[model samples]
Target: MSRKVILTCALTGAGDTTGKSEHVPVTPEQIAADAIAAARAGASVVHVHVRDVATGQGSRDVELYREVVRLVGASDVDPVINLTAGMGGDLVIDPSDPTAQLPGTDLVSGLERLPHVEQLLPEICTIDCGSLNFGEGSQIYVSTPDMLREGAARIKELGVKPEMEIFDTGQLWFANVMVAEGLIAPPPLYQLCMGIPYGAPASPGLLNAMVHLLPEGAQWTSFAIGRDQLRWVAQSVLLGGHVRVGLEDNLYLRKGVKATNAQLVEEAGKIIDSLGDAVATPDEARDILQLDRKAGAA
Candidate 1:
């Protein structure tokens, strides 16, 4: 019997990719539509991040989240909804005046980032493990220890599983500390994010090391960005972990071919199948991740 692997399709991330690829969904309806399409294409879960309608940048607005969730919930297929709590952590500062925040800064208390999670009570939400120099320029993604602890506790209170987003090895270490401190529940879910600017590079050795560091009995998935997105699916499965793919991480299916979220999920399914593993259904994914099925849908 082949092992079961859960595949997550991250629709539209908080990045500024709308202009680069017209496929990046900017509205709640489009994002939700992509989620449904991905689910039909064999994705066990759909990780989501909403963008502002006017600016096309990531937004922490609860209304956007609510609309997306409602649309997906009312759809035919039911995939596990994993809402992003990774927003509201961006801190862009001026180089000359370090005391002054730049135009892109959206820093807020960790708890403030969970308003949507608190309202919807999705099966799973993210807790970015630590802060990082997000990308080029002075932009920084901030998620301190105190903030993470508080966020984890609140998510726990809401009875939602927190998917710890590990961007670097150090972030993984801090996540382990949280688990040791009895903050994260047993069989914690981890998403090893690789190939982002300055975070853990997209290296098999580095990924293997990170996998080995995970606590025993933990369920985890690993993904890389851009050209490495598809390749990382095979790498992750070989290492006894699940996989993630979609427009949020990569836009092109090949050299110059832009892919839709469903196309990405279908390609990832083929990889898992070729590796002699079967894709887990949403209910199967729920069992694997120890998540309770949300009411309605399917």
Candidate 2:
């Protein structure tokens, strides 16, 4: 019997990859089109992060999220929608004055990051589990314990499944604590984000260790960035987990070759098929994740 794998395409992350890859969608229409195309290409879910059309940087604008969600809902394909609540947590502090925020800072409270999630009520929304020294700079992604507790409670109330974004071992530990406290519902969903700077490296041993730490009956997916993106698909599936791929994680399908969101999804599907595992359909993914579709319907 073939294992069913849920493939998620992260359309446009809150990263600065737009300038590097022409295929990275910046506008709502482009993002939605990519989501529909990815679904057609065998993606079970589309993880979305809206960008500022003018600056090409990530934005927490509810209007942009609304537009993308509306467009995807109106389309023929019905892939599961997973909005990112990972924004509004960037904190770039000044070197000289620790109290002074830098130019790139976009800090806000946890609840402030979920206006779009609250309005659109997507089936799944991301909640970055903890703070991190993001990338190679003074930038830090802040998500305190109090903030996470508040956010998780609200997400539970909204009936939107929170995909806990675990960047490191400590984050995973905290996530398990949340589960122990009954903050996250049964079959808690997790996304093990690897190879992103100071967080957990894209190592197979580490991934396996993290998987072991997940609460029993947890649903999880794993992904890596750059050259490891495609390879991580197989790694994830082989380890009894789902997979994630898209322009947000990696710009190229191969060396010197750029990839579209649909292309990534197609390649991931082929990998799953070759491994004797089938890529789950959107509906199958819903069942696996135990999502309440009607609760998230707009």
Candidate 3:
């Protein structure tokens, strides 16, 4: 296609994948190291989600984010930082007692979710565009319309680009709503997340349909979990969109071979190159996303 594809590496997500793969980064230091490695391996952007060092579970501790950002800042490679502001929205309900929230439920207001974004001021941060059943459980990732409006305003005020995470078509609908209301800036960025749970499935037809729904001239990316991760890199790029990969979405590079974040980035880079396309560099990505170099980058 001869297009410049912006590749992102999601270092570690909040999922329970630590035990499944030893390559998943848990501590801030590990996450930072993996991010740098991914950058070196040709990822223009590094998506971060901090985990508790003691348990390998996801955490929203500002200090953890602070440390990760600091480590990345001190590193030689200066990849565009895209921190996850989608935490504190897990609403795990008790099946037996619907009124009671389970122990893992970390529901908080929209403003409460952006503490790290506000404090750290990364180049990009995500906003879960809507609520949905996250998995095969009673838990829902809460991102109501009211909550989105409030969160969008704060993210705008902080001058951080919001990577609108669209799990389903409905979330894409509300994300357009944010754009219509002038909450989101011009050239809104959307991440079409597929194959998580009871949400959008990872299919080319579905990905194409969602891509059609995006606003004209919108900057968008698409990714699928598990085996679909590497495949979607070609799918998304062929459809004229960006791509994301790494341990957060999938662990194994192939059948029985666990992959690190850098390996995934390298694989994606190869995929882009095989198609006669070039991988976008960090500076090119920053310009494409209109990130403020003075404020967002280190």
Candidate 4:
């Protein structure tokens, strides 16, 4: 367990939740500013996913990614920018006509997902480790083995750290395989995403079990959705893992309350401090994750 805990604040997720809450940053400026605020609040990393400013829907435009990276990187507040490579994988399948694609299936190819990362080689990018049934909708997030291989390969080529987003145990196995295939460079970085429907349950037992199963030399973090977000912060700390917080997996700071990414990160910092541990600074986090090329060579 690293003595220092690195905090990651996921700004705006790729979900269609903009209409749900005004706190969700929809424009590029809003997203980047919110991320900068999170960094100022003690987050060492900012996980980002752009949404269409017009409709507040998910978007994969490279221009948007550039705008976000520019805002965060050029700002006085500097946190490791972790752009999401987990986009364009939404697959809404039809149960009735199993073979026929659903009308809402906006699934995309692996190469199509790389433009953002290719254009803006952020410090880190996320690779969804496997497919899962996400949200209350009839949507099943898709990440096929072939697609995963392609996406992983691209991530490696771009020299970006691939943060493996694992929602289940099977995904961990596949992540291990990716490490073996040299898709992701070692010491693997994992995010055990919990409490979402059709995935692993949010519990200490499950968290411990998943943490136990990480590939050797892998660095991992865990977060539970909704109200359990704060609880999972302490849980991850106790389990010897880092933590991630923000509106991506949650919206409220408390019951019926809207929370900004900075507030969420500030809360996470408090938990880390209470545990007699320091939240890693951006530089310290870069060092810990071996993102500082100099440190890696050393």
Candidate 5:
């Protein structure tokens, strides 16, 4: 078993979660501050997704990402920043015309989905492994195989490590395929995203199945949303994987209990320490993720 387990704190996500947790940072400055707090609390990496300042809704603006990168980089804290490249794939197909795009649909190209990552060239970014129905209905997360290939290639060219976000078994399979296709670099990385509606359920059995599907020599981490967050944190570590926790995935420490991003990271660190596994520091995770001083150099 690996003695050091990396802790990743996803600061904010694209989901409509601003109202759910007051601690969820929306603006670039707030996000940067929360990221620094998370890093100081023990997170080796901070996964970020910017939101529109006016509406607190999710956004993919390059300038927003640029500001976030600048603020975080210039801070005293130096955690590896992993931008979310999982945007620009929303497809809310209309029931009337299956062929025609719906009103709420937000479809963008694989290349277009990465302007922020390309601009900032952060230490890491995410490339969702595959597409999946986001929720109970027609809301879909569309990342086609070709799109994934394109995104991965771009991230590679930018010297950004693409954390393969796997929502289910098929996504993991495709991630392995990308490895074979030379779209990604060696020692492939994965992020098991659990409990997102129709995607992989947040259960130990399912998490194990997905974990087992990882490449023989891959680095991986897993997270579950809502109340399942801590469960998956421990589960991932038990499965020889890393752990992720923060306000993005879960808003509360427990029922009727809210938590800050730093509190979440500290809680996860304590859990890992209790399990006889040390929480990896920024330097330790840098070595594990092969991150160098340059953004995204592994």
Candidate 6:
């Protein structure tokens, strides 16, 4: 483990996990505080997704994102913020009437999904590379090719790095197309998402294949959901990539143990240490990801 691993803490995802863990921050204030804590606990980056405080549902409100970024900027610890641009893509189809959309559908244009990223201009924002079957339902995570191109252009225009979220190999394939098309900037960043329903499963062979598919010199991190979260930390480090952990991907630090974002980050740090590597600092992460240190500043 001679490599310096960049550890990212996904502060609070848009998943329906708030009820399962008290540590899942729903409000802007709580999410910001959790991000700060994760940075203090040895995370070089914090990936964020805002939630509605009243309903505990994932929100696309730019106001909430503004507040979260404002609060994180005000903090002493300076972790590179990675805002998620993967929302507003849920298309829950009606089971009986397949043509009709259900109540949870939030299909919007790619540009519409990136208002917060444009306004805040965080160092990094995610662009999910393709659509997904998501879970055991009629739901789908829509990210069409045209949509991705539009999102990638906007992200580049904002001078923000796009953490291309690849759920399957097909997504990775299309992402390379974007890179070739000059939409994704040099030294593209990728997040190899695994272990979700209908996406790539948490398999060592599959992870290796995905890594092989990445463009040369790409900066990447990999994560799995639920029980495989911590396991994937070591797996990612061994594969010569970075690591992501937090309440977003998993709720437990161990069996029967609920985890806070900070706790999850600490565990990831320990895993990195055990592998004979050190967790990267914010400045180091900036260099590795080819990002400006002050990119997020207003």
Measured against the true structure, the TM-scores of the candidates, in listed sequence, are 0.98, 0.99, 0.98, 0.94, 0.96, 0.98
lDDT of 6 by residue, 1-298 (tens): 2788999999889888988989999999999999999999999999999999999999999999999999999999999999999999999998899899999899999999998888888999999999999889899999999899988998888899999999999999999999999998889999999998989999989999899988888989999999999999999999999999999999998999899999999999999999999999998999899996556886
**Candidate closer to the true structure by lDDT (higher is better), 2 or 5:** 2
Q: Lowest summed lDDT over 10 consecutive residues: which window, candidate 6?
A: 289-298
Q: Give the distance in Å from residue 19's predicted Cα in candidate 2 to where it truly belongs.
A: 1.2
Candidate 1's residue-wise lDDT over 71-130, tens digit each?
Answer: 998889989999999989989899999889999899999999999998888898999999
Model 5 deviation from the true structure expressed as Cα RMSD, one decimal place: 1.7
Model 2, 134-233: lDDT tens per residue? 9887999999999999999999999999999999999999999999999998899999999999999999999999999988899999999999999999
Clash pairs, model 4 backbone? none
The RMSD of every model to the true structure, in order and in angstroms, is: 1.5, 0.7, 1.0, 2.7, 1.7, 0.9
Residue 131, model 1: Cα distance from true site in angstroms: 0.7
After TM-score superposition, what is the CA distance of residue 7 in candidate 4 from its true location, in Å? 0.2
- Candidate 2 clash figure, as a count: 0
Question: Model 2, residue 86: what's the lDDT?
Answer: 91
Model 3 lDDT tens row, 230-266: 9999999999999999999999899899999999999
Q: Of 1 and 2, which scores higher on TM-score?
A: 2
What is candidate 4's local distance difference test score? 0.86
- Candidate with best lDDT: 2
Lowest summed lDDT window (length 10), candidate 3: 289-298
Tell me the tens digit of each residue's lDDT in model 5 across 16-73: 8898878899999999999999988989999999999999988898888888888888
Better of 1 and 5 by lDDT: 1
Q: What's the lDDT for residue 6 in model 3?
A: 94
Which wins on lDDT, candidate 3 or candidate 5?
A: 3
Better of 1 and 6 by lDDT: 1
Which residue segments of model 1 deviate by more than 4 Å?
294-298
User: Relative to the unseen true structure, what is the Cα RMSD of model 2?
Assistant: 0.7
Candidate 1 similarity to native, TM-score: 0.98
